[model samples]
Target chain A: MSGKSRRDFLKSTALIGAGVTGLTTTAKAGPQNILSEDRMGVLVDTTVCVGCRNCEWACKDAHNLPAGNLEDYEDRKVLDTKRRPGTDALTVVNEYSHGKNSSLPIDVKVQCMHCDHPACVSACIVGAFTKHENGTVTWDTDMCIGCRYCMAACPFQVPAFEYDKALNPMIMKCDFCFDRTKEGKLPACVEICPVEALTYGKRSDLIKIARDRIKRNPDKYVDHILGETEVGGTSWMYLASKDFAELEFPKLGKNPAPGVSESIQHGIFAYFVPPISLYALLGGIMWITKRRKELDEEVK
Target chain B: MKKFLALILVLVFTIGINAQQSPGKDHSKLNLSCKTCHSCDVPTKSDPCLVICPREKITTVYQKPEQTPELITINQLSDRYGPVYFSHKIHAQMSIMSGGCENCHHHNTSGPILKCNSCHETSRKREDVSIPDLKGAYHRQCMDCHREWSHETGCNSCHTLKKDLKDTKNESLQKKYSGKDHPVIIEPTKLVYETKSDKGKLVTFYHDDHTKKFGLNCTSCHKQESCTKCHDVNNTDKSKNQKVVTKKTFEDQHSNCISCHSKTENCSKCHGEKTLEPFDHGKKTGWALNKHHINLSCAKCHGSKLPYNKLDNKCLSCHKGWNAENFKHSITGLQLDEMHSELSCEDCHTDGNFGIKPSCDGCHDDYSFPKQKPGKLVK
Candidate 1:
């Protein structure tokens, strides 16, 4: 390739890269292409959960991990402290006592939120993460460069890096059992829930169901349905007897994560105007300087 | 077109045959439309679409507490927990005091009372999402009361560890509860509420009078009352007050009584400075229930919630069977002569009113009730 042409190509590539990064995120809320119309979701009525932790056992078994003795999952002593999803365990049930007086503590299962416009997918520079049609945010290990940008960008702090491994490392999080679902099977946790605290259905239908539940049981449930609109929307929703804030769920607005940044990105890369304008200004300066130099040479 | 015609002809013939072959159910007499039970226009054997029994209304299965299975082993989807030794009889008895068999068997159309797994799926991941799963149904039923009374979420309360299933602690508890009757709650005769209202400081309730005298069933006023209403051990004064968060008005508290009693008139009747005594039949009605009437309920004769004015204190008004033939004349401490015995009860008892003094003029200027004797008195 000629030098001039190569320089032009590099300049255009950098401009395109800047535009792609810019268009990745915004604070504005709206419908996005990431979530399909009938994307499946899980409605978690935390009020119905009995903190049995059978789901934890099923999750480990499905992932080909050692689940320990299945009977030991019922010990419930491990719930003494709050825990998050980790490499060892894809899902963990945490027991949160509402207040000092409440005898019954609420159990919340921690996993990936799988946002409609996932911040992980947005932050992954290599385009490794993908939002599946089944509402699962999955990532390909081969494409990942061990950047761990997804872990930093995740609002829920879900993704765990296998830093202990000196060999090939992998990011760990709940995949929503995408492979199992694709093969006409239910997600491991959802299939094993005895009390049906976790309800699986279309994401649209789940929102309606959550709303209907709150409407029918005014006294039994708080009005809010978490993930219905928070961070644009998520595949996993929650309904609780107490306020979600008291349960330690992060408060979020009804804005698509990629709204503001995408706008700035589009504006800078619109019809190659930014790069072309820069080149034109540089060309004008070079022309003036070259003319001055020629004039000085002639005067000499 | 020919195939369609043949199909219609077959359908008509089938309908005709069905009508002719059907036994005497008297469908016409029942005045039931075809859609009453069937959900389809043409109910076929393949997809009959039989309408689901309405579950909103509690359909009672006629099961006495004693007739029900006393114990049930709940080991449907458990590996870690042992089969729960459910004390069914005790719970059934408790259910009667609160709601009836319909409390648990709310959708029981007929036949045996259905188990939770009969309708509810054992697993959560199923096609139908309307009804809860077996575990959900169990917990929902139990927690409705346990939440209010025990306030416990401990699985050990209902479930024992599989490893310790043979432990004496669990085994003894299972044996103690299974096949045993629940302790009967001795219903209080009277209750007094210290109303915080300015109009009525105290309200005295005659609980036994409503049961024995008024003939009201336990369920009439106690509908939807869980065991927690009375048995909540954790409900101390501060908690009890806090639990009654749904602010009820003064009239709302008195709503149950207002259905029969005057709500606006005579506030002092129920609202007294002190707790009042139960209503005495003799003191209130000027006629005490003697030996024969003592055990009988007021509705046995009244048969209606009418005012006392609607009932006249006539002997035959209630004693319809006290005719001349059926009446045990000897029980009156007298065996009448053959002639007098053959006569009707009204013959000597002039107005046929036993309360009134009898005249003898009806038979041979016969013996009056007090002055003269009809025959040798047989005690």
Candidate 2:
């Protein structure tokens, strides 16, 4: 290709990168991305949970899903098999044998951790997911294009897709009971817990409560609070008697899940500097090489 | 008028000081160190500096099971279900073998038994999440043991759905448990355990002898027994059911006996080829228990400490208080006549050896005991 044509191509690419960078800088200032200090969170004390699946029933009922008789959930046989949150059930509780007491099994309610910096928010091509100021990561059904990138992006492997549906399949996950909380109500799971194992409060307050519980009952709970610093902190945290790994919690680093990808993508387009510089260097090299070839031909 | 105002101010100051000094609940009677409840050395009325929820350290006011109410209708926070009919007396009685009142009424001070709502908040949504709400507290206390023994976490196990209740008043339900008491626990007389010990296979435990004869309290051995130990709902036929022998550490396996029996003692002391008889003073120690000693508990002579110290066979060894003036001859089935009663006990008894038969040869010739008695038989 001619050097002149190559220079034109490089100029167009640089202009496009600058335009995209400008658009992203504007999007970052939106109200939906704010992380408020008083954002609500839930502290799940797994030691107190009694493996009653009432929370499962309550979740479906509150979400307007087809929840059968509450008594049906009392069949503990379902707990024998490990389960994940699916399109049908947004949240599930699993029982693990207690490390200290066999009779008292540890029941952990699994759902979206509602991370402070959600990967889904960053991964969504259409900007469908929003990390609200209140610590809930909610998705806009109308804006969602049925892309499964969110399912892959979630650190918890949450956000199940309706693969069975042929038309208008949607991503489903725990929304932290956004609608209920907007009306000044507790999340369905926390409200329905008979033992109040799930405590809901401000994110800052919940962390304090979680710390106090661990301090008071050192023997009853392991020192670590899962999701406190995991994936750059999650709205929902856990207190277990033993290590969280045994409970099937995904081991994750303290860094936010989207931190690496966001930084690289943003850095490459920031003020269009990197793209422009690379194009200028390539053009200079092409010009020199073409001049040297011409000079050799003249000598021959 | 100025002097009168000064007098009123003085009266108010004294009253304030009295109130500050006297906390409503008296801690003087409680056998607990100040550090148990208070974190600081000198806790003032304004800032008590009390330890927050010192649950393990606080002593519970234990009441006899019979003195407690037979049935309690827990109606607070009953929305989806009717009030639970809790058998308070039965639970209190069962708790004796476990942790007693402290198991449920944890964090109780020396004062009157505080209601559950005192510490546990009524609403689930509260400022402090350190302590569970009333609903959580009540359910945790019940389900901890109920789920263990019954293996059922169904709401129906403890509650009747509000819709299912025929009588909202629950008059019949109250009558069902009003005067009801837990049936008397019939303790086994003996238990023969087949052990894996090579020295001896059979280990006999005399339950009655430990409780009645040895004077051991039920709590001494059954301190932390689980509810599943006795109420095995899964085991329909107790006779046919084989106990799942859990692998316990050597110390845990012998904990109940090791408290009384020395750990250094020989294995054959408990493990034997056949079921050992209930502890017999004469057979085990060669000193026969007589009419007076037979009715007395073993602790009466051996002191309450276990592995009872052996006593030498001497009348004065145990009866140090007894002397010629204080000693009653009639109580020994013999009422000495005027002549014999006047003589000192040593004149006939010889060195106060009550275990040996008394001889008349020390006082008079041809007056042999049993043939010609010095005193008449009381009976």
Candidate 3:
């Protein structure tokens, strides 16, 4: 951000002492996460989705999240109430009205956006979260301290902390089916979408495709492409009939979310000047208070 | 002042020359206002500021089955299955019987049937979020019938399995649809149903009378019906015999006739003691639909919702708009001669109805229809 924030960031790494090298390396990486140019994306065409929750079932099954028979997902009653992605269900589809007084409803599937500049990785005090080169924002369960800072940082509110687990808990969210994609398979949700509403491809190629569609069918679509530039780009994109805000997507800026937090945190720790001054001030107060007590005891 | 005028003239000449440099596409000839294409008031090469896809003034389009495309290859989207070879002609012809060309080509503004990709995007990765993608479009259209008939959607039905992954189990589908005819829909003359009505158990439906005498189009009553209404078999599904669920509730069954006819007030019209005979125009209205009127649709004379008995028997009541130029006089059994044909029908026939017999008293004092021949008698 500014010279101040940059120094603060450097000072924090300096204060870490022995692990300073590793922390500094991660901070540089965190600010500018080097991802493959060919990192993939999933384009969710909400209009094509029929509210058949097959993708939801497939996601649960793939994640081993205790999903019932996939056929039961056919009952569209679940869509009557809008639901968000939780620990058990990695992905969920929510229904929004297509237009004013319109009978037809648009089904928008919600999950992790897998930001190019991930806020979770930035917010994690420990180096647990990773912005993988393949465009997946994943977290190491063993390293997770259950701080839930990622939950606060994520713009989409994707990551959920397992509050019920008394012994061991972990952050849960869509991993973009990282394991499956590594094996040359599609994400479970993308693979199972009956209408093929979710199209998986290179992010740049997907943007080109989306722009082409908008140009060809001007009457059918709004010009803007969601997730293309929102919060400095995300791997999971969306296409909807109405304004994305009406579809329950939060209004975001072109600037990445982590940039806001990183600037302040970095500024406060810049050059170790504030921390050193703060500690000295506290130490002086402690010394004065003890000296005052000693003088009172000597008088007694 | 003279130098300024000359500079202006030179500027105009340079602009004229620049305008002529671009040829062939004559935008000025279209007589459209510059604002139609140009977004800026003053357009230049660097900042032409052209508008894209201005959707106003949609013209209604019309097409017939024979005039539309015959076949199409849908291969834009890549998946495991091979692209479908769709029999566009066969489907078009079938639609002609059911709902005409608009059954599939629903949103034509003007010109020929629009390509599917015109409205539907070819790829799933698209910005047009209102209409479906090409794959979705094809499936949604096809599944209207496919889902209704079989209630199962296996990809191999429309798409052929890829050559490398081809199995013996996958049926040879590409060859089956060439020039395939959906068998002619048979119309029954009458159907007598036993209804739950306490006043009358039987309800006789004169199907032929409604179509022939009443002149109702098949589509007027069968709106929103699936092809599986009659073509109910699932021959494509390998499953031997799945129970076809072609159930219609009371409302669904009665919705067609009830739109115009009174289902609440006029129960006796349809409900009867036993099977009733076919509708007789002579018995019903005291005037038969004779040779001249028999082939005509009911709307031709009855004016869509106009009652059969309400029309005056006078030919002029319905033929008020017709004149000698439009009403072929030769079709009336006698070809009018050159001299007499010049006179309007009202001049010779004092009465509006031609059955009153024509008189030649105005022209020839002693002449009449049988006595004097004004026109050649073809019959």
CA lDDT of each candidate? 0.78, 0.86, 0.75
Return the lDDT, model 3, position B67.
48
lDDT of 3 by residue, B1-379 (tens): 9999999999999989978654336655764556656788987778877776434532223544554445666777647667666777677666755666677777653433357787777655444444556766777787556644654444545766576454432244435654555556688777666656676777788889888777777877765555665555643543232222324577766776787675665677776686677777778677776678878877778777633337767777877788767777778778888998888888888765676678888788778887777787775
The global Cα lDDT (0 to 1) of model 3 is: 0.75
Recovered native contacts in candidate 1, as a fraction? 0.36
What's the lDDT for residue B277 in model 2? 76
**lDDT, candidate 2, B69-170, per-residue tens:** 777889998999988988888899999999888888887756457789977999877787777889988999998888888877889888989988878456
Q: Which whole-number lDDT from 0 to 100 does residue A177 have in model 2?
A: 97
lDDT of 1 by residue, A1-300 (tens): 565787799899999998776676442233245668889899988988877787898999999878987667867688898898998899999988855225466889889989998889988999899898889999998998889998987878899998898988989899999989999888999887756788888898888888889998998799999999988899999999888988778888888666556667888899999989999999999999999999999999
Best by TM-score: 2
lDDT of 3 by residue, A199-242 (tens): 88888877887888778877667787899999999998887767
Which stretch of 10 consecutive residues in model 1 chain B shows the poorest summed lDDT?
B238-247
Residue pairs that clash (backbone atoms under 3 angstroms), model 2: none
Instruction: Please tell me which predicted candidate would have the highest lDDT against the true structure.
Output: 2
Off by over 4 Å in 2: A1-27, A31-34, A263-300, B1-60, B191-204, B236-258, B262-268, B271-278, B305-307, B321-379
lDDT of 2 by residue, A1-300 (tens): 666697799899999999899889887766663578888899998988888899999999999999999989889899999999999999999989875556677889999999988999999999999898899999999999998899989999999999999999999999999999999888998988888889999889888888988998897889999989999999999999999999999999999999978999999999999999999999999999999999999999
Write down the TM-score for model 1: 0.63
Model 1 docking tier (incorrect/acceptable/medium/high): incorrect
DockQ sort, best first? 2, 1, 3
TM-score of each: 0.63, 0.78, 0.51
Q: Determine which window of 10 residues in candidate 2 chain B has minimal summed lDDT.
A: B237-246
